[model samples]
Every structure is written in C-alpha cells, then in structure tokens.
Target chain A: MTENSLQVSSIEFSYGRTRALNGVSLNVEAGRFVALVGANGAGKTTLFSIVTGLYAAHAGDVSIMGHNLRAETLKALGKMGVVFQRTTLDMDLTILQNLRYAAELHGLSRKDARERISEGMKLNSLSDLGKRKVAGLSGGQRRRVELCRALLHKPALLLLDEPTVGLDMSSRAGFVEHVRSLCKQYNTGVLWATHLMDEVNHDDDIYVMARGEIIAQGRVSDLLAAHSVDNVTDLYNLITEDNKNVVESGA
Target chain B: MSWLAALRCLRGVITREGLRFINQRGRFFSALVRPLVWLFIFAAGFRSVLGVSIIPPYETYVLYSEYITPGLLGMIMLFNGMQSSLSMVYDREMGSMRVLLTSPLPRWFLLFSKLLAGVVVAVIQVYVFLLVAWFWDIRPPVMGYILVVPALVLGGLMLGSLGLLLSSLVKQLENFAGVMNFVIFPMFFASSALYPLWRMLESSVVLWWICTLNPFTYVVELVRFALYGRIHWLALVVVVVCGVLFLGAAVIGYDPLRGFLARKDGGPRAG
Candidate 1:
C-alpha cells in the first residue's frame, strides 16, 4: 500500500497551444493537509480538474489510495471527495436532499445514506438546517454544507479548490480549523488550493504554483528560509516574481 | 459500482428530475399549453384547408385534431428533449455537472441514467398532453392509449438522446436559443408532425426527402401508428437505431479523453 493518499505525477495538460499544466506533480499522505497557493490562472483549478477526473491529463498518472486514476478510475474516484471552486449544491433542494443525493451518487444504500447524512450534518454544525433550502443559507453555511456533502462517503482524500473564497474573516478561520480537526479525526488526506496566503500555516506543506508549474514546495518555514525571507508572504512574492522575471526575460 | 448501487443512483437522479419538474410549475403549464394551443386553435383553423385521406385506424375521414394528435404528442417529447439539453448547458455553466461526472460509477451509466431521467420527465408531459387531448374529444381507441406507452418511451428515449448529443456540443446557455431555431424548428417542421409526408411530397419532393431522412419523422410515424393499435416496423427500427447511435455519440462526447467538454475550451479549434 502506498503512503500517499493522492499522488499526481508528471501530469501535463494543454488547451490548444496554451499549456494549462506543464509536468505538474504533487502528493498528499494520509492524514496530512497540504496547502496549494497560486495566483489566478496558475493552473490550480486545472490540476484539480484532472485529479477529480473531470478532465484527462495529456501525460502522467494520478493515483488515489493506490488506485491509478486512468486505469482504475472508478476505484480511484470512489476513494476521493472534491469541493469545487464554485459551489455545486442545488439551490432548489433542501440541505438534506443535497447530501442525500450525494450519498446515493456515491452508491450508498438509503438506510446507510440516511445515517451518514445525519452524522455529517451533525459534525458540520448543520443539523438544524437540514430541512432548509440551501439557497437560504449564508455563504459560510453553504460552504459547510458542501464540506459535509464531500465527507459523507468518508473519502480518503478531500480536494478543495479555494473553498473559502467569498467567506468572511471569522468564517474563514472557522472553516480552516474545522477542516484541520476533520482531517485529524478521520485520518483523511486533504489538498486545499487557494490564493490566500493567510489560509496556510507554518507547519503545513505548501506548494506554490505559477505558470502551470510547481515552482516551490516545502514547509512554510523551510520555504521562507530557502528564499532568504522571514515570512510566507515574502516567500510567495519572491518565488512568483522570480518565475515571472525568468519567463519574461527568456521570452 | 454494484448493480444495486447503480440502481440506487438511477432512482436518486430520476427523483431529483421529478422534483425539479414539480417545483417549476410554470414549466409544466407551458409544456402542456403549447400542444393544447396547437390542438385547439391551429388544428381548428387549418382543418378546412388540409384534407385527410383514409389512414389506417380510421375507416372514415378524420378530424384534423385527431389526425395531428399523435403528432402533437411527438411535439411534446421534441420540445422537452431540447429543454433537457438546455438544462444540461445550465448545469455545466453553474458547475453542478462536475459533481455529477465525478460520481464513482461508470461514466456511461451516469450518462444513461441522466438521459433516462429526462425521458421519464418527457413521458410524464406526454401523458398529460394526451389526457388533455382526450378531454378535447380528440380521443383515440382505449386500447390505442395502452399501446402508446411503449411508443412514447421509445420516442422519448430517441428524442432525449438527441438532446444529450446536442448538449455535449453546445457550450453555453446563451448560445442555445440559436440552436433551438436551427435544430428544433427544422426537426419539427421537416417531420410529419404538422403535415403528412404525402402532403410534403405534393409541395416539394426535396422537402419530402428531407422529411424522410429526418429521424424525428420516424418517431412521429411510430407514435402515430402505435396510437392506432398498429405498428410501423420500419419506423420502429429507425427510431431504435437512431437512439442507439445518438446515445453512443453522446457518451463519446462526454468521455474524459477526446470529449467535447474535455477537449479545447473557450473557442473552436481545428484538429
């Protein structure tokens, strides 16, 4: 068995002549949380798409819990959960219905689905809002509902693409803490992609992406030290700015 | 996924579609209204001009409403098919499609389940239209109604599969209205929905050929015959074959590799 819950190796993807992902590779071990920080159009969403099986990579492999994505797609997907950049909940449905549907899509029986949904709602502080329509929920509430939906099946790896965008400061902090606790409690691997520097912590593994490439990856402290910087913000600036200069000067 | 699991997913998808249809009351009213207006108003006005020959299940000359009732039934499925496609475009744009595609089941099972769900909704609309037509005194034989079930299912699947194929090709919701004009109108007009193929042949042989070539024409004919307690074998074969072909293409269009959605984004590109 592989230690990595999610492994993306040398994956390349292109849209016409515009390369969306250029030999990008990363891994998340079981029970570890990795933060992926990148600017807009930095291929974070593109990489997420490939890992979620929404798009095929031009080259290389993605494995979820030791199942190769392309060769054993069903098995691989069965072990993964995803929270897309945009909210995907059906606004017309109640929170309960949304979670129930997600459970069924993952092939859970009704009896099992009911139990899991109730447990998920309870865990996410969404127990009272089960009957309420998702459209009526606050942004933070809806995001929490999405998290519950993704976690209902007890996926081995949870991939979130900027899950906290449009959230308030307090809600963002709440979300970060909740996700951290969930990861520890469930022993689940998580790859959280975002552009916000504050979302990442000192001890977390940080992968900085730019121009479809993983330019730097390490603990925040190590990254900062390697760049001769004192903090995460400075390290981010140095790497992205340095990559841009190299590209611009070469072009 | 296990067969039972696949069945569960199908149940969920179908239930969601049913709930969506029920929630949108306006859509229900409109889906029924269009066919009713055509049956009550258009058929009445055109009855005098369009004379009918003694077609099977009719020993005597029939009313235009009766003649076109089956065609109108086909029309319901046609419009619903396109509406389902429009919903697909909307789903894709709103990001819900990603959630659906990421399900752990086989991709083909997921796509087929979605198509089946749409067909179920269209069939419900079709039955409602038939009931209203019966209330309007455009009644078929009681046995014809019973036999029409299989025909409606087949026709619904055929048209719904075509919608699936169209949805895979159409990228944006804003561009779908143009597709309605180009695909829906041409399909509805070029088929035997409003007029008999003989009438089309009398007007122009070219149109008659086009009508003959259109898959919609076969579905319309299949429904027409089934509603009269008869079977049109050729049309049945044509509709089934077309359904299979369209469904196959749609599954390919949704394939993770080389699929329309997975291919180039933003604009069209040459191979």
Candidate 2:
C-alpha cells in the first residue's frame, strides 16, 4: 500500500491442519534493512517463502516493487533474490560454477555472468575460493557463496533466511558486516530472518514474530525501549512468554 | 520468455546434473552394472531356454541378450531418471529444491529442463552400454545406432517424466524404494522388456494385451524396432502419447495449489 519495496497483507498459510502463518502482514521500504526475528516455527521462513514465490499464501496478497506476487511471479522474482535457510549450492560444483549456474538461471550470458560472479565473490570476500568445490568449503564460506549466488543478478530486494545459522562468532560477525555493507552499497532492500538477537543492529527496523503473528514492530532500540527490555533477546523472551501464557490460558 | 534465457536455464540445469553425476562415482558404476548384469548373466541363462521367433522387427534369430539390449537401455534410463527424481525429493527434504523452485524461471520450464538433463545422462549411459554390446559382437545396424539417439531421448523423457511425477507425489525419500519394487520392476517386466510380444502372446492373450497397453512396452518396442532397422508407428505413437501424458501429470502434480505432492506437514513451512 505504501509503494514500498515489499508488502504482505493478511497472509495465511497452513501445513495440513497446523496453521503456520495467521493473518501475517508487514511492509518493507526500499533500501531498508528489516530484521525478522522469531522463535522456531514462528512463521518467519513461511513469510520469506511467500515473498520469494517458493510458496503461495492462501489468504492474502504479496507485492514486490508494485508487482502482485500471484499475478506476476516471474516479474516479481526477477526483481528479487533469496538465500534459503538451507545450502542450495551444488556441493560438487566449484563456487564459480554454482554462481554461474545461478546467473544463467536468471538469464545472464556466460561472459557477463563470469564478471558478475567475480564481482559478487569480491563483495562477499570470497574471491579467493571461487575454484574450490562447495563440499570442501567451511560452513561460513558456503553461506557466503550462497549469498554471492543470490546477488549475481543484481536483485533489487535480497531476502536472506537465517544466513548465519551455524557460523562461529567471528564468522557470524563478518557475515553480518558483509550483508550490511552490501545493503548499504547497492541500495538493496533486505529482509533478514534470524533468531539470533545479536545480529539485530539497534538502528535497524525489527519485526518480532511469535505464534504466527508479529507481536512487535519498530526500530530495534525503539521496540526494546517500549517493551522496557534491555536488548533484543530479553524483548524476544518477553513476547514469547506472553504467547505461551495466552496459549495456556486459552486467550 | 527470451530464447536466450531459456537456453541459459537449460545449460545451467544440464551442468548441475552433470556435476552431480561426476561427483557420485559409485552411483555411475552401479547404474552401469545393473544393466550389464542383465545383459551378461541373466541373458546368458535365458538365451538357450527361450526359443526365438522371427518377429517382424528381427531379420534373423537373435540371442536373448541381443534381443533385450534396447529394453535394458530403457531400464537404465528408467532407473537413472528415477534416481534423478529421487535426488530431487532429497533436495526438497534438505531444502535445496526451495532454491531452484524459487528462481525467476517458470516452474514448468524449470522442471522440463531437469527432465531434459536426465534424458541427456540416460542417453550417455545407453551409448556406453551400446559400446560394450558392440565389443560382445552384439551390433544393431549402423544407421539404427544413429536412430537410437532420438529414440533414447524420447524414452528418457518418458521415463524421466514418470520420475518427476513420482517425485512430486512421493514426499519422502524412504517411500521411493517401495515404488521401485512395486511400480518400476512390475512395469518393466509386465511389458515386453524381457521378451517379444509374440512370445508373450503364446503364453497368454491377457499378458499380450497388458504388454500392448503398457507404455513401457512401446518404449522398449520402439527402441527394439529402431535397433533392427525398422520403424514402428504404433510404438512411436504410444511412446509419444505416454511421454506427454506423464509429463502433463507431473506438471499437475507439482502445481502450487491443488496438487497432492505440494501438500506436506511439518518441516520448515514455506508460505
């Protein structure tokens, strides 16, 4: 509604009888980095899936850059890139080949794809490992390669689903920094899904989801302040605690 | 929509499949071995027991192994196609399929590209097996050798589409072995894969009708007819019809909404 980078209005999804996303709605402005923090099964991945055209939402609408997701999936997807929660890289392929494959899927020429891949690798500090098989790369390095692959086609909106799931402290910090730098440098709207509180910067917009709903949404510091919490972890705990209590009390 | 884009996607799919095949050396060897075992040991045992009838497609008396080579080729494609689809189900379970399915390319094209990639691999394996057949002095006509490429491609697509159809319907990898045992083997055997249709007719009219009805039989017959320097229109029609039907079923099976395969419980919820 805001002509923002992305808009999800009243989306509902279910896995059989279990409702995964219930009336979920959110908006992300152009070039803004929005952190979606939630507990496991809190519908963050479900939301990401809908936005990326991986799954269709049953009860609402999603738009990317003014294109309706249902009506113009390819057009919307052309303007977006997603790094799934799992490693999608061909483990047998070299990092270069994987990136090239992604680029080709997006319709780039081989020579052009090669150049863009190199640029992407350089952006992610993975230029040195282009020729290495993904199977041999460290978890963090594989994550970076996945990120590089997502960015190969210069997508306007980049959706990363738990990009730092299994990384060490240093690697997580390094990866987050690279992500922030990419968003800033390229003016790419980013919706980063993560359960880790430490990854949410104070200035960034935050959406705290629990029980298939967004319970809190604002700048990280503002939401934390409004909730009278010291940090994201405490705020998350408070929201999830309230959810659990509601469930127990049948409210 | 552009041809260039489609071509690029096609290349990507083929390269990915090729890389996967190269990485799994043991699988390649085993795929080769399954067909060879039938060609050498099983065929040798049955060669004397089975009397040869002069079928229209056969110019002279052919050994059991020679007669079944095309069928074995179909089996190789059949198995390999299923293997590729099995990997796709694994990819879905492991979350890799989400990446491919979410790409900007149309889902149907993406799926067809994957099928084509399987076809390419199946054709390669068939050629390798043919070379070995040649070494054993089992040669189809030279022109038939060339004709086998397109025949193999059609057969590969038909089998590969069945694989995709299975992948879409079967959510878990564990269920696939059951499919192989119940569906694949029965389909292969019930058809004329091991013997000629006339041979089947002598045994039972019902069995002959079943073989005629079975699409796999047509694929095998098509390959067999081509191998012997003859063209079978009925077989070709059946193969083409089955291929299109299976591929259509696969597409419907994978539809985002209203597809039983797309329905799943638990795991990371996508939308």
Candidate 3:
C-alpha cells in the first residue's frame, strides 16, 4: 500500500476443508531480499502461488507495485519473475533455448531475447553451458539455468521457491552469492522461500512462518537477538517449538 | 500483449514442440510406423473381405488400401494430437507445464500456441504417411493432394483442441489410456473413415446419424472428397463448426478463473 514492490493484505486460501493460508499479510519494499523460512506445510509454497498469480486468494488482495494482482496480472507478472520449487525447464531443450523460450514468452523479440539470454547466462555463470541440454546438466547447474531463465526479462521483482534445495555446499554458496549480487547490483526485490537457516545471512530480512501465518519478521540479527538465540537455526527452533506448545495447550 | 508479442510467443512454443519431437526420434518413427502398419498390413488383410463399392469420391472400385489412405491420415493426426496432449499431462506431472502456463502471455494465447504446435506436428506426420501411401500406389489427384494440407491442418486443430480439453480434465496420464480405448477408437471407427456413411447406414440408420453428428466423420469425409478433386459442402460445414466449437471449449477449459486446467489440488512441493 505504501509503494512497496509486493503487498498481500489478509490473504486467505483453502484447499477444500483445509485452510492453506489464513489471513496472511506481508509487504516487501523495492529492492529488498526477503527470505521466507518455514517448515514443510507452513503454507510457504501456497503463499508463493498466490503471489505469482498461480492461485487466487479466497479473501484478500495481492498487489504488485500498487497494481492489483487480478486487475493487472499480465502487466504485474510481466514485471516479475518466478523460479518455482519444481524444475520448470524443458529437459530436451538446450540451456540457451530454454532461456530464449522464457524471454520470448515474456514478449521479447527473437534478437532481443537471444541477446538477453546470453547476458543472463553470463550473469548466472552458465555461458559455457548454453549449448548443453537441460537433461544433461547436474542438479545445481539446472537450478542455475532456472535462475538465468527467471532473470532473462530483467524483472523488477523475483520470486524463488526453494531455489537451492538439492545443491552441494559450494553450489549453494555460489547460488546465494549470485542472488545477493543480483539484489545489490540490479536493485531487484527478491522473495526467496527456504527452510535452510545457513542460507540466511545476518543482514538479510527474514520472515518466519508457521501454520499459514507469519509468526515473526525482521532483520535476521534483530529477530535472533529478540528471541535470545545465538543463530537463526536456534531462533527458528525456539519460535516453532513455542508455536507448537501454544497449539497443544489450546487443544 | 500486442499481436506481435503473441505471435512471437506462439512461434516459441511451436519451435519448442518441434525440438521435442526431433529429440524423440524413436517416438516419431514409431508414430509413423503405427499408421503404416494399419495401411499395409490391416488393409491388405481386409482388402478382399471388405467388399469395395462405387463409393463417391471414388470413380471406380478402388482397393481397400487405397480407399483407406485418407482415413489413415486422419487417424495419424488424431493419434498424434492425443499423444501431444498426453505429453502435456506428463509435463504437468513433471512440472514443465506449469512453466509454460505461468508465462506472462495471455493464457488463451499460450494454449492456442500449444494447439498450433501440435497441429504442425500432426500435419508433418500426415504428409509423411501420405508419402508412404503413394509408395503403395494410393495417390490422390494432384490438386486435391495439395489441398489435403489445409484439410489436415484443420482436422489436426479440431482433434488437438479435443486433446487439450481432455488433458485439462484428466489429472493423471494413467487415466488417459482409457480415453484412447473408448474415445479415440469410437471416434475413428464410427466416422466415415474406414467405410462410407452409406455403408454404415445399411447396418443401422441410427449409426449413420451418429456418424453424421461426429466431427471426425466430417474431417474424414472432407479428406476423402478433397483427395478426389471434389469438395463436400456438408463436410466443410462440419469441420468448420466443430473445429471452432472444440477450440472454444478448450480455451474456456483453460481459463485461469473458470477453467479446470489452471486449478488443481496439490501445490508444488520442494524437492
């Protein structure tokens, strides 16, 4: 509402009788890298779905740069990029072809798409692997290709759902560094969902979610200190354990 | 999006589909072989048993193999269209379909682009089958043969739209086998594909009416008539009407809000 890159106000989403998201609200300012940390079934993926226009919220509004999700999904989505949790690359396509396809889908011209894809692949450090098919790439390489595809259009807001779930430590670090560099250099707002506390830097903004709600959100260092924990993992455990105790006591 | 942007996206989808087909060479060979087997083996076996009549669009008594070439072409398109749709379901399961669907383009245009790509592949298969039919001495009139391109394209579009409609409703690829057995077979056989509608009428007028109602029957009839340098008004009407109807249904079936294609249970889980 205040010129934030993303604003989800009291969004509610349900799958049949099970409420996946319950009156969830969050906002990400422009050019900020916000990490959403939650355990499985914490509605992290569901929240991403709503934000990317994959699923409509039952009872709330999602706006991107002051444009309503429903009213300007194409325009809003055009300015946003997403890397879904699952592998979205065509296995048979070469890395370059996949990025070119994504660029074309975003309405880039053939020449422009090719140029942008080359730049994106370079940015993701995948220029050498352009001619290689996605099926032939390693998991980490594939994830990097997905990232390059997401960045081909130079979107204002980038949403990544568990982008580094199956990577080695070095690969994970490399990916995190690339993401950090993107945020710093391009002024691109990023909403990254992950459960790995080690990926959370002390300076990064963090949102800890549980049972479809944001239980805590602030700078990682600030939240950890507020919870009297030495690190993010300790802080996460304390918050989740406390929530579980509250739920059990209520029951 | 502008029309140029839509066209670019459509071209991208078609290019991707082409690359996929090219990469799966074995599948392409097998798709071509299946129709050839029906044309050579099955038709040869039934040539004498299925007595030939002076079927219109046929000047004299033609061999069963020759008579069934266009039908077999239609069959090729039909099967390939369904196969493309089947791949779509598999892609959804594998998470690739979501990538395509979530693109910034208009959802309907994205769907239409996919349908067009399927049709392009189907047309290629049909043409290859036609080449083999010629090798077997089953050639149509030259002009009519040229016209078959557009006819096959239209038929492919109609069948591809039906495939899209089915893909949206079917949640799993395993359930699609039943569709091939029930829907595909009946649609291919009940039509004027293997036999003329008049031949079907001798068995039952009701069956004749059903064939008349079938859109595939129109496609077959259109192909049959066009192959002989003749055009059937009724067949044209059927193809145009049914093609538009099926494509409209497919577009609606994929609508973000109202369509089942965009709404399914189970969000993507981290893997």
Candidate 4:
C-alpha cells in the first residue's frame, strides 16, 4: 500500500492465442512523464486497459497510489484518470455537462465539483468554451475537453493512450505541452502511450514494447545511448529488428 | 463506496440516460408511435375474433382493448429494454462506457445502476403510452393504475436484463437486428401478450408450449394480473427467477471484469 503513482509488475494478458502483454513491468513517480511507445498492435491499449481496470489481466498486479487494482479496483481506479483513444465526450452536450458527469462519477461533492470545473476550465483554457458543444470544437479542443474531464477529480495518475493520434502537427505539439505543464504543476504521474516519436522528449522516461514485452526502458537519452542510436526511429529499428511493428513517427 | 457516493453515482447514470433520451427526438417519438400503431392499427381488427373469456384477471368478458392493454404495456417495456441494450453496445464501441467503468463503484452495482436507470426510462415511456391510451378508453380501475406500477417495475427488470445479456453477447450491430427478429418477435407473438395461452393451445399445442416456456409470457401475465389488483403467483415466480438469471448472465457477460475468467480460451485479441 505504498503511494507509488503506478507500479505494474509481471503482468501477463492474452486474448486466446495472442499474448497481448507478457511480464511487462514499469513505475512512475509523482510529477514525471513516461512515454510508452510501440507500433499499432504492441499492446499499449491492452496494458492501459489492465491498469485502468477496463480489462482483467490473465496474471499480474497493477497498483495506483498504493491501491492494488484487482482487490481494490474502486479505490485504485478512483485515483487514476484516463483518456482513451476514442472520443468519450457527447457531441451534443455542453462541455460543462460532460465535465459534471465525470465529477459526479468520481464522487465529487457539488461544491468541490463546481470549484474544480471552474478552476480546471480556466487552467485548460476551456473557460470560454464551457457552454460550447463538443461537436463544434476543433480536434485539439475536443481532446482538451477530454483531458479536462480526466483532471476534474484531481486523480493521482493520468493515463492517456494515443491521445494525439488525429490532431494536426501544431495541435499535437500543443496537446503534449498542455499535458506536460499541467500534469507537472499538479505533481501528477503520467503514463502517456503513443507511437509518435516527436510527442516524446529526451528527458522523459520511456518504455518501448514489442511482441508483448518491454524491449527497452530508461530515459529517452539513455535508451538512445544504450542502443548507440542517434534517434528514436533508429533505436526502435535496432531493438525490434525483424519485428514488423515498429514505431511510426519519423520525428 | 459510501452511501452518498453510491447515491451520487446512481443519479449521474440516470441523468445521463435521461439526457440521451431527450437528445434523440426521433427515437423518443418512434417509441411512442410503435406501441400506438400496434394497439390501434394492427390490433383493433383482430379484437372480434380473440374469443377471450373468463380469463382470471377478467372475471367477465372484456373488450379487446382492455384485454390488450396490459400486453401493450409489456411490449413497451420489452422494446424499450432492447433499445437501451442497443445503446449499450453502441456505447461500448464508440462512447464513454469505458469512462463510466472507471468509476470506483463495484462493477456489478454500476451495471445494476444502469439497469435501474434503463427501467426508469422504460417506465416513463409506459406511463406515457397508458396516458395516451386513456383517450381511447383503455384502462382499468383507479386502483389498477396504482397497482400496475410495481408490476411494470418487475416486468421492466426482467426484459431489461434479457437485453443486457444480449448486448454483452452481440459482437456487432448487425447481430443485434437478428436478435430483435429472432428473440423479440418470437417472444411477443408466441406468448400470451396478443392472445391467451388457451387460444394458442386451441390453435396448436406446440405453439402453446412455446408461449408457456417464454419468460416474456410470465412477464406479460404478471403485468396482466397485477394491473387488476392481483398477482399471479406462478408468473411472479417465473419472472423473478428469469430476471435473476438474465441479470446474472449479463453481469458475467460484461468483459470489463471477471467475465473473461469464465472462458477457458478462444477469441482473437484486438488492440
């Protein structure tokens, strides 16, 4: 029951014949960003599903804020916020309505929910868009709304899976910066999963998955130095070798 | 979860459902229209030949509309239940079902909350139909209206649980339409909803058995008696047992939790 932001150990998950994740383990401390990079079917979403309690692991343990996800699913998941790859926001509802639903789901009091919604909206540059419909927002603004909802209850850990997949170049960078700055200020631990290399930073910790295993782990620079590669792509190429599913971003 | 948190989560689930119903104006109107057409257009003609008499709930001969009223109520809940199930499948695919699952509440309770929310929506729709049917002189004693509430609650729970089960099993939207055709239509037509079991037996003993075996028949019969200030003990038991069975299956069918643990193996894993 130690207050580790996230501690996944010896996790194994399989969907019939295909093992999605195998003996994968990682940790994130408060206020740190860790990028999980892998190709499309590399099990990033499966691992996130297991960690967020969306899917049960065949054999493993996931701890969030000292709470074991299996035995204390409610407490563990309650302490974690997630942005799934798909859009969860209602296109017809106002942003406030969407955020309020999350607030209530997390057991926030009326006053606390109100305060957080207001404060979060302002912090996320969503104050003016409170009454706006999600359908009208740009791709990036929509992602921001999802991010805002994830933060409404002030979870200890934030998990975002392929969050910037559809955004334009500038929008993608803006989202990465937005998450980094806000999550840092709140001292929230982050496990951001993506295939895009540019969305990651040299200073950030990294975990590269291939064929359901953690092929590499360390800071982006450490991974590059260890593999003797100058770039993320080259590092991925060297590590994965003939494994067809490699990192996507040329950046 | 504390009582207050649990209550708050339930309220949120119901409110979200209410909002979705309101936003879909076409669906709302279509639900109302479907029952009205079945009661007035398709059913009105078949009334003369129904030959219903001394049905336990009907001490004396009753008009076709009066005999048909409770069945229509059952039909409304049945379709509403399936509609809500369709929405669940759609939500699991493209919506915030994942977000809702992240709630710290026990997974079973969250699903029950969803079932209850769906029941609430169905009951409202049922009442609206009844109110409209009143204009056509379709109702029972003043007390009948009051007594029917609990019956509708039970009936809604049973049918909604069945729908929940279907939602979990149906992989794609295409399969759901088949369920509606195979499950819903057969359950409605083969049961005592449109006609009595005796009439079905008179026509075909095999059809009668099929009607007797359908859980929806018990649901309809339960509503039939309860609407008239009585309870059919057999129907009551069958409905209760079927409700429990369907809900249990649905909770297990849901993949978010230990549902997968039920299987030994076999299904392609997708990212």
Q: Evaluated with lDDT, which candidate comes out highest? A: 1
Q: Tell me each candidate's i-RMS in Å.
A: 4.6, 2.2, 2.1, 2.8
Task: State in Å the error of residue A74, model 4.
Answer: 1.1
**For model 2, how does the per-residue alpha-carbon lDDT over A60-173 read when each residue is reduced to its tens digit?**
999888889899888888888888887888787899888888888899998889889878888888888888999999999999998888888888888998988878999999
TM-score pick, better of 2 and 4 = 2
Top candidate, metric DockQ: 2
Backbone clashes per model, in order? 0, 0, 0, 0
For model 4, how big is the iRMS in angstroms?
Answer: 2.8
| lDDT: worst 10-residue window of model 1 chain A | A224-233
Kindly state the number of residue pairs that clash in model 3. 0
Per-residue alpha-carbon lDDT of candidate 1 for residues B173-261, written as tens digits (9 for 90 to 100) = 88889988999889998999898888999999999999999999988989989988999999999999999999899988888787898
- Measured with DockQ on alpha carbons, how good is candidate 1? 0.55
DockQ of each two-chain model: 0.55, 0.64, 0.57, 0.53
Tell me each candidate's TM-score.
0.97, 0.96, 0.95, 0.94
Q: Quote the lDDT for B89 in model 3.
A: 83
Q: In model 2, which residue pairs have backbone atoms overlapping below 3 Å?
A: none
Model 4 chain B worst lDDT window (10 residues)? B261-270
Query: lDDT tens string, model 4, B1-271?
Result: 6989888888888888888788888887888898899889766887786657887988899877778788888988899889988888877777577888788888778888888898898888888898999898886777988888888888898899999999888877777999989888888888888888888898899999999999989988988898889999999999889999999988888755567322424221333
Cα RMSDs, all models = 2.3, 1.9, 1.9, 3.4
Off by over 4 Å in 4: A1-3, A228-230, A242-251, B255-257, B260-271
Residue by residue across B147-218, what tens digits does model 2's lDDT show?
877777888888889889888888678998888787788888998889888878989999899888888888
TM-score of chain A of each: 0.97, 0.95, 0.96, 0.93
Compose the digit string of candidate 4's lDDT tens values, residues A136-239: 99988989999999998888999998999889999999899999998789999999998888888888999988778898888988878887878887877777
**Lowest-sum lDDT 10-residue window in model 2 chain A:** A1-10
Candidate 3 chain B, run of 10 with poorest lDDT = B262-271
